[model samples]
Target: MVIPTFETTFAVPMTCEACIKDIEGSLKQLNGIQKISANLKEQLVSIEGTAAPSAIVDAIQSTGRDAILRGSGKSNSAAVCILESHAPHVENKVRGLARMVQVAPNLTIVDLSIRGLSPGTYHATVRETGDISEGPESAGAIWEAFKAKEGTACRGVFGTVEVSKGGVGTVFLDRPIQIWEMIGRSIVVARQEDGKFDKNDPDTLVGVIARSAGVWENDKTVCSCSGKTVWQERQDEVGRGML
Candidate 1:
């Protein structure tokens, strides 16, 4: 059986009942048998079950919001999460919320509390992309890949994992995303222009996969899960609304 835990921040503003209800519906359909609890006031969630926490997370994430898993321990009372985005306006916000709901409609999701966090602030949206124990033999390679990152710091989390490399210029979680490591090795290859090469440039492989996964600038991406590399289903609405 899998006992999952997390501590994360949501970037979106969570100051109303509608917001709570909105996220709650996102996690209800994840592929697992489970018991779950969410604390909106403190921004947390807790679950005990036979499924991987990442499964729950990827489901919650389809709602266009980031769900990061922080730390886990047996017998801890509270699980925490953070909101990571804010809408451009009222109608756009509504549509964004709807997209989140549409991403994972059947997981057992609960929207905990929203405190004094700023609106539109992007934070670490981590979740385990690993597995609890390889499910039935019928599951595919994607499941196999996700199940591999469990228990480590990457459990139930994906995307831009923060690395605390030592330096005065680096005290934050803005490092390269850990998901890129899932498939193969990442090389620091750079595209050059002018008389010098720019090392601070974004690479290509990540862009290729992200675009393939429906997250290109013009794509309406849902959960940027570690394995969602191909745009399997098309979304009706696609636009670059906000970051």
Candidate 2:
């Protein structure tokens, strides 16, 4: 749910400043996040720019709070509308991130993207946005083997690089690399050619959203013998069994 100025509102339930801080912190720390304007009083947080609402919900949900996407820009739309949620847009930002693992080895790209997209909506946007991937380049590797072409990184002269998943290319025509934060299993996403998710199918988004939060279908089992889900103990047992 990214839009003009990358602002997507969230309908959340909180009790104190700590609550707000938690939400803000969780949302802002994502890979692509740039700025977050969270309001606990309104029980809402307008996540500005290039990120996804799924990340917001996952963040709050992980913290034991319910998070629902309201809407983007101005409209008489429902606060928890899924219309835009299913529009054709950038696929999961972390889909092929494992391939780009060497891009920022030190930063450890998490499934968080709210920090790099706080300026405007990704819909119809044609310009690069943030310097979210300031990892090795900042550290100065100074690789002279083949220094990139014109605009291939966060400091490129042209626009930033845009990741496309399940759609067309939506490269920002003015910047360098468009950074996205992939949270734990929670993935930060954007639109491909238009920053709009698959609007024709809501089910698609649902599946990925759940997967993004480490949720599997139909109470799947991580522990075949005990019929329990995988977490720490199960993982430890698996490791021990192999030993």
Candidate 3:
């Protein structure tokens, strides 16, 4: 099967040609990368590849710089889910984030990142309903269409994310699913025990997938509602353990 490649842009801090060279050099070491372009004046790096966005960000950060995704894929093809735990005892409920981009008609790439969870394997799935009033239990079962189409025992399963001892996990997955079908659906991430997730676990996180900006779709650095710059918003997210 041929994996489709798409363009993704990131806002990086670049002051001179050396900065671009460092980032470009780092990205070249990753697999599935086809092309790399960096604009020093704009402080943006555009990459054409099948690599996960999270992986690309990590690579750039390795050079002692932060990389924020500016846009990805085509118009209306990107989605985001901010996973938050409903556990009352947890101070910071925002434990994870999932970014989805439809690179092809039937293929979507998901960048899943989780933190502040027990060190263990966790499974993620898209539930039939987005209703999280009662948490994951109220999210309904896995979408039936996935089972029927993929012939998998459990439907809507994206895959597993193995949390490290530091309470962090990251996974990049490409599934034969469309981004539009996942919109308004709830994505659940739960601790896996004996290879199965316990629905009753209070630490389970759930979030509804919502459409995000595509390439060149969002350009404003300051938010109108919060009156915060993009960097400020990022710092706030980091403070809440969303990084």
Candidate 4:
């Protein structure tokens, strides 16, 4: 019987056409790779093959680049999408992705990536309400909320991520919050246009917002060799609403 091929995608940091060639050349060294397609503009690579996911990722990283396994079509414990702003927003394109990884019963790591934003100071945070469907507009009230609270920081402020001239910034937040608490929440990216944030100036508000990622069905079934699998342990913790 012939083994069926599987598909996997990697979120790579590719700067140019040369980077695309490097990825193709490195991955070709692996056996059983049937097809490969790379999009430099999006920094995504798709591969259909029988190779183990690890081997494929290693190959890409071996070329002196970073790679994050987005998922195979079947399922994966993450969500990703390009960030969008309403009309009349800045011209720069923004891409945002959130991923959850459970490191311990009480600890979950939330990885965030934002690319193609203006090179300057920006704040990334989670909000009480705001769905991906409404985009950043859903978080417009966040500014007023900050003013009402008499604080410099907005509500649900996670942390600050710096975007360089290359237009890339990353944030890693480790919290006891469960995966369920994260999903369906809004992630807002606020730009400090005048080098300072003023509640009085609506222009100092956010431009991009997205819903955080969530876990998939198969993510809970991969555990082995234990009384309670990792996923089960996390689910138990989630029920308690923290850690």
Write down the RMSD of all candidates, one decimal each.
19.4, 17.7, 2.6, 15.1
Residue 147 deviation, candidate 2, in Å? 40
Q: Choose 1 or 4, whichever is better by TM-score.
A: 4
Q: Residue 234 of candidate 4: its Cα lDDT?
A: 51
Off by over 4 Å in 4: 1-82, 88-94, 132-134, 140-155, 192-243
Q: Candidate 2 overall Cα lDDT vs. reference? A: 0.35
lDDT of 2 by residue, 176-201 (tens): 22223211111123333222334333
Span of 10 residues, lowest total lDDT, candidate 1 = 204-213
Error of 1 at 18 (Å): 2.7
- lDDT score, residue 213, model 1? 18
| Candidate 4: clashing pairs of residues | 176-243
User: Number of clashing pairs, model 2?
Assistant: 56
Task: Give candidate 4's error at residue 181 in angstroms.
Answer: 1.0
Query: In model 2, what is the error at residue 229, expressed in angstroms?
Result: 32
**Of the pair 1 and 3, which is ahead by lDDT?**
3
lDDT of 4: 0.55
Let me know the TM-score candidate 3 reaches against the reference structure. Answer: 0.91
1-243 per-residue lDDT for model 1 (tens digits): 122322232223245666556666765565443555565664545544433434555555676555534333222221222121222222321111101110111211222221122232211222223221221111112213345455554322222221122200101121222233322211111111112222222120010011011111222224465433122221212232211
- Top model by lDDT, which number? 3
How well does candidate 2 score on lDDT at residue 186?
Answer: 17
lDDT of each: 0.28, 0.35, 0.85, 0.55
lDDT per residue (tens digit) for residues 173-243 in model 3: 88888888888999989864123344445568889999988988878778999999888888988899776
Q: What is candidate 4's lDDT per residue for 71-155, written digit by digit as tens?
A: 6534333333334443344443335555444334444445566665567777666555655444454543432244445645433
